[model samples]
Target: MTKTALSHKSASPWLEDMRRRFRTLPFLKATGNTVFLFIFFYLYLYIQRNPVFEVTQIPATQLDRWIGFQPWALALYLSLWVYTTLPVALQPDLKQLTKYGLHIGLMCALSLLIFVFWPTSVSAAVGPREGGGMFAMMYAVDTNGNALPSLHVAAAVFSFMWLQTIFRSVRAPIWLRVVDALWCAGICYSTLAVKQHLLLDVIAGGALGAVAGWLSLRSAGRGKIAG
Candidate 1:
């Protein structure tokens, strides 16, 4: 057989396996994750609008100024919703999906609790730009509260960790992993680029995500989900 034919034959099983894995529990996973998103957003917006304590302002760093505002990065910032759902959609079974949800849900709960007691916001001087469009609508709805430990960055990193594990388990290509990393990085960067979060918020959010992802994977036996 030719080398091309041999390579194709070798790659077929993992590709088929990945397809089968993704096909598992599709409807159930989508519905459950969607419902969780709605609940999370409702709680988040409620907390944002009604902070019990004085909202601490997060200071921008030189990095923030260097990155500056990029109106185009809004697409990357908003892509976080779709990015976060990929792992849940690709879970191989109900047990694993449930476990993933629980871990992420707990992380969000902790963040929400922190929001309640120690609310934070972006510096007014560097807030989202003024103008009518998606940015205006986003700013109107999201406001400046819940700034520290950006849930946007946290969710992106959490999804990144889960996706890397999933891809490794399926023997996905190295390029696929690189794309995953780039996507996660873009989402994290967008938080700052759009002036939605400061440098400190991104750092804290990344830390929160790493800790939660590590704990979740550890509990899942290093991402080995039994059939």
Candidate 2:
């Protein structure tokens, strides 16, 4: 067989296996994601509206200034909600699905706690004018508080880690893995490009996400998803 033909043959089984998993308990997975996300947003909005501590503005770094505001990045920034659902939706069984939830939930809980205690906000001058359009709506609803350890970046990173593990376990193609990485990177960059978060916030959020994802994978006693 030609090398290209051999490669395709080798890849077919894993691709078929992934398709079977996606067909398992589809309704339950969708409901779980919807309910958990609703709860998360409720808590997040409540904390944003009522901070326990005095709100502090996050100071911008030179890096923050260097990355100019890009209005187009709002698409990537908002895409985090959809991106996060992928990991949970792909879980092949209830056990793995629950574990994913607990780990991600804990990470989010920690970030919310920090938001309540520290209560940080980004300066209004950093981003686009909130006079009208989607930016105005986002600014109106998601007002700057909960700035440090941005849950947005943290969630994106956490999802990326889980997706990476799942993809590796299924022996997914290299191109699929590249798309996953690029999507995650775009979400991270969007947080800054949209001026919703400062450099320190993104750094801290990335660290928090990496640590949580690493610990979750380690404690699960395996690096890849259950086959």
Q: Which candidate achieves the best lDDT against the true structure? A: 1
Per-residue alpha-carbon lDDT of candidate 2 for residues 16-98, written as tens digits (9 for 90 to 100): 76777788878998898899889988999999999888888888888888898888999999999899988877887778778
lDDT by residue (1-227, candidate 1, tens digit) is 99988877787665766777779998898899889989999999999999899888777787877877788999999999899988888788888888999999999999999999999988564644655699889988898689888889999999999888888887778998999999999999998888888889989999999999999988987445523
Worst 10 residues of 1 by lDDT: 123-132
Q: Which runs of model 2 end up more than 4 angstroms from their true locations?
A: 1-11, 124-131
lDDT of 2 at 105: 90
lDDT of 2: 0.85
lDDT of all predictions: 0.87, 0.85
Which lDDT value does model 2 have at 27?
A: 94
Candidate 1 has which clashing residue pairs, if any?
A: none
What is candidate 2's CA lDDT for residue 59? 86
Candidate 1 TM-score to native: 0.92
